[model samples]
Target: MNAQEILDECAALYTLPGPPKDFGERTVSDRFEPAAVPTLITNATIWTGNNNGTEVIHGGEIFLEGGLIKYVGDRVPSHFTTNNRVRSINAQLAWVTPAIVDMHSHLGVDSAPNLAGSADTNSMKALIQPWLRSLDGIDTHDESYPLSISGGIATALILPGSADAIGGQAFIIKLRDTKDRTPLSRVLEPPYSLLNGTRVDPTIPPRWRHMKHATGENPSTWYQGTRYNEARKLKLEQDAYCAKAQAHQWTGLPAQIPKNLKWEALVDVLRGRVKVNCHIYETTDFTSMVGLTNEFEFSIAAFHHAHEAYLVPETIKKVWGGVTPGVAVFATNARYKREAYRGTEFAPKILHEHGIPIAVKSDHSILDSRFLLISSKFAALRKALKGGLQGEIGQWYKAVAEGKIPLVVDVAKADHIATLLELKAEVDEYTGKSLRLTLTHATEAHLLAKQIAAAGPDVGVVLRPARQYPTVWDQKRVLPGPPLSAQSSVGVLTDANVTVAIGIEEGWQARNTRFDLAWAALEANGTLSRTEALAMGSSNLETLLGLEPQTDLVAYRGGDVFDLSSRVAAIISPARGFVDLI
Candidate 1:
């Protein structure tokens, strides 16, 4: 078929009609009935939308009907007026938090261990490149998503970098490593603002002009006046090129300009849809750009690699909306030609503390699974390690990790967990539990149980029955009464039992209370607590993103997301429509 005919056929197949005429509020269609719903979920510890763990109901049941959290507190409703289509999961010590929502990332395009080849990632030629959307180059097979999920990251905001004086748009994505039928549907779009662009901020000033001198009786030194004109001409040409680029006015890009892809991207910036992410650090440059940005009517969204943010904190805060500094790029004397190295990470943390609604991101080409979180944590810790106690940012994290004054801080782990938690809490709070829970049985869970049973009959016993007693059962003897009694002579094992605990006590205690001694302990040992490490990978990360976290958690005793060490299997009943790991 001709190209025209093909286009026409495709258009016909894709169009859809608008909403029905009677779609007004007064008239209800057969489309949705809020009253008609079903009951689901049994015996789970729900991290209530609030940040309080005590608010978390342990061993309680939740019922979802018509996609809403119908009955939430304490127990499931005994009576449903309608034929209750019920689904239950034995949430045996597994968490039931919201899904994770990572606020900062570049998952789809730049995968892990980024190499030099992804330079096409940015269009630096143009001072502005707004039209360059990231979704166009997103790779479904980007290894970063899978690696992130291994750390329990569910959703992410994949954004462009501040390469050009202006950057491109941003995209929100889910970290689901599967054969997704629709790639575009997975991305969420929202307007991003780039309040500032990149500027070179130096710690030490360079020796320029070296005392300009003009002597009437100049001596004939070396080349005296020989070929001086030749060098001056070259320098003037170089200066002119820079001057022309700097004088680039939007008065309809020069007609002679080729159809440059970078310029094309800039058109979008001109239209004001994409935010200009400038990499600025100096006060003078910042002042200069503010006027330019105002004239263009485009705002600066973020500032990247801002080393001297503290110098112009108020000015930067007033101009650019956000700042993300490097974690370890400190104590350098390179470009300080004009300004002094005020401090590292001071810009972001101070701004964040002063209510900038900060979101820390790793300015990396390829996504490093742990870099985002680790980088953020390092920023806070480095400040703490430098400021020594007066630093609120470091103290906040230190307190979160039980304030163990460890010699070495696993900033990476702390940062990861922190972001995860923040993201989770945001989602849960915004969209109350209306999740479509699909319980898939993991055959591995059953296999692992078999192996545990095969260990020995004596290995299956529990001396004291705790709240999780039923979950802790000896599979050596399936039947509870006589068979279990007969195996009693073999003796009971505590730690070896496969049963898990899903209580929120630990998570709660970690958040609500202050544990300076604990942090001191970590400091003394040069290590973070296990809970703190886990938080780095989970809670802390979610919190940072300002999105809700999917805590509909499913865990395996023998194996974590990284390595399935145990041979456990989960048997799912089709009739029940859900599976529980026993």
Candidate 2:
């Protein structure tokens, strides 16, 4: 209402947004815990997540002090030895690297155990709601926090669910629990003016803010209309409001800056103050969004669940400001819905070849953030195979009969075993002898491992989730591993000469992948080596999904990361500027 207030509001409107001027020069992290003591870890085999994920150090040392990585190399600084407060840790040749960063997740917003009021992922009250924030719904007591952290997840970008065209704002959070025990405490780089009542200082650059947007089925299906028309109308309204405020038009007596709670965030997008992450699939959706961005004169940060992005890299490059939005996708998760029907495992490789930045993500709860790294491994593997080995119909039939090409059949029920047998018989009758066959999610395949193994040499079983649970009617006869039974399905199948591989069924199960492989190998009783177990969880998964290599890292102690005897000792996080001891 006053001259000073009006001037301050006008100055805030035009000030460009970015990190503060002194952000890069800071020695201590904003999240530095005062109680955290300095630590020195030595003698470790570190997978530095560098050189395209191929760089490895046999013996390395890392120093952690003042909530930052003071040093990392083959030797520690001489000054560290003189400090009495510094703690020393012997890694015993264990693996170490930067902590994992989950590119897309809904960890705290959609808490685990599926309780009645746990989920706050979406809102169908309106089609467009850019002002809504995921922070308001974050459950600090989320059960997945400790579990995901134990799996080496240090940070995750908590995104709002794609239930509407413009769902809401997203916030990045660190997994560690702070002494404050509040959601705000866990937030990373929150905008300086968000909670402050005082006017924003014009001298400092504002921090970047994130918003969630969607295209295609999700928005249309929920709102029963196209998002373009509605969004355009909103944009026009925002332009009018901004134009009036900039012109100092006084429709009311006070002459204050015009403000609309609902449209403020969307208006910021046009001003290039918000980084938009759009959930899109299919070529049509991608093109539509690209056009939207260009017309609105804003840039999208990335496209999440962009199943068909690989098919339209050129269209993505056409986004406003000449920056191609990164494509975040799943490794092998696809086709459960109509929109994802065309998704392929080779998408990452295709996008990478086209010069698009690619990242593997877990739609958490949808994919489990703990095993986020596994998705990358899967993507890497799929990239190597380049859409897998295929043959002509006639050649395939001959290879199958000759036990060369394996036919993978998904059988969850014990009765499905009969169907598999019938298919095998049909193949044998059509060709000569049916030999090559593999069963995935074969919950009860262990009961007939002898018969399946007798069918062929390449015959094998893949136990998804690595553990069995009676989650569905068909999986009721699950062979509960360990305490419940001496030998697991992996043990039973391997004993009959049927090869076995461990896998995950859900997002939460992803974090437990290492344990699953370790358990499978343990039950095999000397049949599987430590390296073989590690491959099942890492290399084999990468081969399956076609994910790109990551630069983040994790640290293990006593043994290999995948070994049952080993444990996560610390996280050397270059991104967070601290080595978090566990």
Model 2 segments more than 4 A misplaced: 1-5, 80-82, 198-200, 221-254, 372-582
Separately for all candidates shown, the number of backbone clashes (residues 3 or more apart, or on different chains) is 90, 19
lDDT of 2 by residue, 92-159 (tens): 87778788888888998889877769789998888878879998999998999998887678988889
lDDT of 1 at 199: 13
**Candidate 1: C-alpha lDDT:** 0.40
- Give the Å shift of residue 109 in candidate 1: 1.7
Q: Give each model's whole-structure lDDT.
A: 0.40, 0.76
lDDT of 1 by residue, 1-582 (tens): 133333332232222222334434332322224554465566788777675345687887766655345666566657742454566667763446665555445676665546555433555455344456676666775656666775556666566554443345566666664344344546532221211231122211211000000111111111232222332343344344334434654244332322334343333333332344444555665565554545444345554344555455566555522342221122222244333344344455666565544444433333354444444454544444333355666564344333222121111121232333343233334434211111011111222333434333311211111111233112122212223332221112112342211112245443312232232223323343445434433453343222256454445457643232533355455545677787
How much does candidate 1 score in TM-score?
Answer: 0.38
Best-matching candidate per lDDT: 2
TM-scores for every candidate against the unseen true structure? 0.38, 0.62
lDDT of model 1 at residue 393?
64
